[model samples]
Target: MPISRDDVLHVARLARLALTEDEVERLTHELADIVEAVGIVAELDLEGVPPTSHPRGLVNVMDDDEPRPPLPLEDVLANAPDHEGNLFRVPAWRQ
Candidate 1:
């Protein structure tokens, strides 16, 4: 099915886009070409082919999580310019 100027205009209105006459005309052709290409792909014979989300097999390379000793409070606060008690002090956002 070929995309029409009215179809493009309707979509533009829904998206809150302000398209010019030239833009609407150009998109009508471009969208039509895209739909036609997808239609060609849809016509392929692949009844036995399993659907895949990615072209290549992928696996997580991360190591298993392990508990570790916490850092010293002095070391953690070493880079802080301002701190109150054990917490970093930040400027108040609201009056």
Candidate 2:
């Protein structure tokens, strides 16, 4: 069966929530309607059909990994806003 008004209030209290009386009543009806609809779906016949996570088959799109040459030190350092020798300098972050 669907949840009741008292059930909603009990749950809210357990979750440390503070709901008005009106909210509890509204949620009870909403939840009941949803449960009734779901009951209809559960009664349907879906025999001999395999369950699927997705409607269509999916495939990964990736390229094979390969080694490459490194860029020049001067070219890499040129993009840094601030640098000390060959190393990039960043603002202090940790306390």
Candidate 3:
């Protein structure tokens, strides 16, 4: 699973990247190493291992939904830079 220099350049071209010779050479070696690592992982022996998104079990720890008193309108609008009645006001962008 060795990655070629041309393959790296092709990908860089598709991504609209202009890589220097030094960067291209470095990326080619790095990508080849990554592919080789993936190839080694592909040779694993796991017959009945279930695929999981996370290594540990996840549980919903959300609090019980409860109704709460609403804040005063004056308090809510206190920090607003500009407000008209109960809504925020902004400069008109269109005629």
Task: Please write out the lDDT profile of model 3 over residues 35-81, one tens digit for every residue.
Answer: 88778867889889987876687767799899899999999999999
Report the lDDT tens digits of candidate 1 across residue range 1-95: 98888899999999989999899989999999998988887788999988888778666668879988999999999999999879999999777
Q: State the local distance difference test value for candidate 3.
A: 0.91
Q: Which pairs of residues collide in model 1? A: none
TM for candidate 2 is: 0.41
On TM-score, the candidate that comes out on top is 1
Ranking by lDDT: 1, 3, 2
> Could you tell me how far off, in angstroms, the CA of residue 69 lies in candidate 3 after the best superposition?
16
Candidate 1 lDDT (Cα, 0 to 1): 0.91
Between prediction 1 and prediction 3, the one with superior TM-score is: 1
Put down candidate 2 lDDT per residue, 26-85, tens digits, no spaces.
888988888888878777689987778876766686888987889989999998999999
Error of 2 at 63 (Å): 7.0
User: Every model's Cα RMSD, please?
Assistant: 9.8, 11.0, 8.9
Worst 10 residues of 3 by lDDT: 52-61
